[model samples]
Target: MKDLFHKSLSRRSFLRYIAATMATTAVDWFKIEAMASTVEPKSDYPVVVIGAGIGGLVAATYLAKNGFPVTVIEQHDVPGGYVTSFERGEFKFDVAPHYTLGLSPFLEYLGIQEKVELVKPPEFFRVITPEHDLILPQEDPRGIIRVLSEKFPHEEQGIKSFMSLLNGLLQEWVKPFDMKTISSTHPIMWNLSKLNTAQVFDQHFKDPRLKAVLCIFGSGFGLPPSRLPALVFSPGTAASIYVGREYVKPCGQGFSNALMQAIENNRGRVILKTEVESILAKDGTVTGVRTTNGKTYTAKAVISNASAPATFEKMLSPGHVPDSYMAKLRTYRPSHSYFLVWLGLNKELRGKFKGFQNVVIPEHYDPEDDDKATSACNASKTRFQVYIYDALYSGYSKPGKSTVKILMQCGYRPWKHFEADYFAGKKEAYRKEKDRIAQILIERAESKVIPGLKSMIEVMDAATPLTHRRYTKNPEGAVLGYEHSMDNYWIYRNKNRTPIKGLYLASAWGSPGGGVNPVVRGGQSAFTDLMLDWAKIK
Candidate 1:
């Protein structure tokens, strides 16, 4: 799970890499232990955020902007948690190829609109299926309808109805969400909340292939339609697709740097490489946090951007969390992880590539089968997104080369067994397994879209679920955090508030769920809740 080249990059090396990023604008922006009897006295900050993920950074930035003393602590040397980038040779690969929305409004609100660049990707992305190859424009519902209707003329009315419904849902459902007026009682959303994506699709269309195409966007949530909550799928996946802008950073470093800049400019402290040992609390209220390096930080309020399960099970002691809350956390399941292949090619693929973001779904991909196979790491029927950054933007690679990132949803089950003692002969097997899977995935990509893709590779590195766990320490490497299922969509999505007062959750796992935009929104919600609580203080 370490770097592809190094056994363990030294602290100096980490500093060098991170320093380069920081110097350039990589805004280098987790969990718990026991309460200590004696510790040095420390001045209390108004807010202390655990984990420097996008959510944490956003919350910290807001608090600092309002003139509250805030500090963010991260386990990693860099900031941005899932929004990070890693360098290998001349190429820098984004940890996650985030398609962002709400960046403009967020930055504009912070009075830093011009400070960050929200680069729109090439207007279109292609979906390759057995029966059809569809090139859909970004945020264009009619384009999608035209394509689908043309592909399935017999289902023209169905396609039109589906697309129209999605568009209408966008104007009706998503606006309230953006305005923060959405509630569990909202009639339309409440009804939508009860339906799974598959159920909604069934009512609108019958063609299996067409349904698959519609469900592809929901895959961004790391689940197939059948299991995906309609509320999550409709607004963001289906409807929001027409309204939401799609973007890719030349690299996320600059974006992260902008966030950190916003925070520091507001007088917030972003502490790196400082792992939070525990969330300090007394009498059901948060005291602060203690770090691994024997340093204790005192704060009136704390927000955790780490995984939800880890925050409760590992970060807090038994009494600090209530039995009911613990029971709810226990019921939550982490979402699917990913198996990624980062390739630095020897040649530019722009001329040969058709789209900035490409998806390859098997000819007769069944959503149910896709859900099963991918979660089990079966590449045979796996659906994946091929993000050719070089095609989208030029500065990401050397003059003649390009960077290709291949992502497939995979579960941690297959990779977890490899964590046995290395000296006991498990290491080589793990390495070979990673290589084997990477080869299969590469072959899949080559066979489907790019012929001779293996020959073009100059540098290739792969990441398993284990790598994700090792880096972010997310439980089971769930990249998007806890799954957003119908069960949790309305009543159970963990909110910013916890049983322990003044300790709030602010990560992908929190309410509003995953994706960079949602996490940022979650952070804003956490900050809003904190402000409300603060106002209530007599």
Candidate 2:
């Protein structure tokens, strides 16, 4: 089943979108207190974690398993942040696509790997455009590169150089992925940083079209290649070159389940539906947190998997925080959010499409076009990047049913497009937009594949920026942390350590930015910070 995710990653294959399909049973993480043993451990334990999302959970698991008791608190009924799923009658929607999944060394360091379910997809990304398309097999990125070179023969040189660079960066390293640690110790990274992603592309990629294709990898961070540091792309591309740069995990059953299991298996405590509204801070050091409900739990150290802005803005007293840190949070740009079309269909799409992922780039579309599109959406009119999930995930496909999910990437800015008069709540607005955009998207995709998919309506649903905000607590509904702007990406990418003493930031909001793989890597880095040096008292 996991191999399906790897295989579907090849952009040229239509078989990736095939899915087995679902229903409306709500998973209550709270009631499953059985998962939480009768023994309430971690009393007076060293660390207290805020938000049981991926980063927080990983950090908690590592700390607890290493003999330090840890407590993980969450605002939601369930954990996993965006990496969770919900069922509506026969349809199940994975709110976000998480691919290239990996559990960092931190998992092994804590020795809880067996408690979690982890699998590497056979391959990760499948690239598609009207002009050229391909099925990039895992460990065979050259196949996709050939397709790109074949598409634009005049740009073969640029294409080859681009793929080579990306492949080298994403390769699995014997060393853990860490932006801060590696920059100081790894000479390879030091040399790579000489040229930022933009400078590298300008220096080698003469073909603008090829540049657009190669740089799309930057999308892993909600960034464009031109703006990213070459160092960021280096490690990022290494993984993509091997498996097409995308991987998928079940947010509901797979990801969240693994997180909770790991936490409990390590003797840690997880409490959900409890939002930590304010941190109980003293002078300049640490303490515990007070949930909005007024319950307070004390601990020696606090780690946050919440977004950098939320932790600083809402949790800690603004006065205790550094002015510099506050300014960084206040001004930090959140990532571009998304709009989704989730569908439950009655037919098998395996034969209809060869790839699990299909990407459509309009003729001569400029990579910068993404910037303009997101900006326009910030104001009113917004364009979209179409993601068709029809071929690879058989898990979503029931015995006789299939699922079709499409993604329309829009900026969080345009969420205000709904007039204040018609601002209807999240659920209401989502229902209205589902019909309107679903029709348009059906027309667009049907013309490309299903011939008449516009009529194949069994079930349909939509999610707007507001939905992302409500579910993920992403401010302004930004899907992937802060938006990646040229001026801010390098500096704005937060560090794992925060100014508030005894606290650290994990997850995509910090270094390594967003995407499941990098965040996993970020978890490993965060653990090293806690155990290796930071805690080794002289």
Evaluated with lDDT, which candidate comes out highest? 1
The sequence of per-residue lDDT tens digits that candidate 1 reaches over residues 262-360 is 899988999998899888889999888888888988889999998888788887877888888788878878988989999999988877777777799
Superposition error at 522 for model 2 (Å): 2.9
Candidate 2, residue 402: the lDDT equals 65
lDDT string for model 2 (1-538, tens) is: 0121233244332111111000001222222222222323435446778887777776776666555677888888878877777787776777777765233333444454454444443334455555556455655656666676677888777766666555333222323345667665555555566666767778666767666666555655555565566766765565455534333433344656676777787777899888888777788767888888998878667888888878887788768898977776667678777777777777766556655555545555566766666554421222233343435555656655566666666766555666343345534664665467657766666765456565665777777777677766767777667554444444446777777767787777876567665566456456555543332431
lDDT at residue 225 of model 2 (Cα atoms): 62
Task: Give the per-residue Cα lDDT of candidate 2 at 227.
Answer: 59
Q: Over 4 Å off in model 2, which ranges?
A: 1-44, 101-124, 167-196, 243-252, 378-390, 393-395, 417-434, 484-492, 532-538
- The candidate that wins on TM-score is 1
- Cα displacement (angstroms), candidate 1, residue 229, comes to 1.2
Question: What's the CA RMSD for each of the models?
Answer: 10.7, 8.7
Assess every candidate by TM-score. Answer: 0.88, 0.81
